[model samples]
Target: MNNEVNGDGPDSCGIRILGETRDLTVVNNRIGNAPKGQQHIGILIGEKSDRIELRENELSGNLDRKIEDRREEKLWPVQIRR
Candidate 1:
């Protein structure tokens, strides 16, 4: 919580939840907005991740989609899911 993230890469993101990550919570953060011409994403939930929560986050000015969940079976958020 209370973080501001920025990165530069083809797959760069403000926050990235990858691999077998589970039972996690992300809240009250500001994500994305890389320098001009940089590829930046706000939140990236990877394919194998699960049981994650994102709450009250502010995502803006990303080069791509604000939040990208690449899970084959998408889940909803009373909290959030990968």
Candidate 2:
């Protein structure tokens, strides 16, 4: 199966994390195939969010991908592996 997201603006990503969310893991998934004219992302970690883990995942065929800590503070660690 193909994972798709057809939309614009914030939270219109294949994976999204926001607020004070932390200690989370996103692993072993196939994320792709966004609509032709939309703002889609491979992964997104929003403002004030931290400690996110993205491991052994495949991200392709998308629009925009801004994957990281949006905030300047990180108490733990974020891991992204393939």
> TM-score winner among the candidates?
2
Give model 2's TM-score versus the native structure: 0.74
Q: Candidate 1 clashing pairs?
A: none
TM-scores for every predicted model: 0.73, 0.74
The residue-level lDDT of candidate 2 at 69 comes to 52
| Counted clashes in each candidate structure | 0, 0
lDDT of each: 0.70, 0.68
Error of 1 at 56 (Å): 0.7
Over 4 Å off, model 2: 4-6, 66-68, 75-77
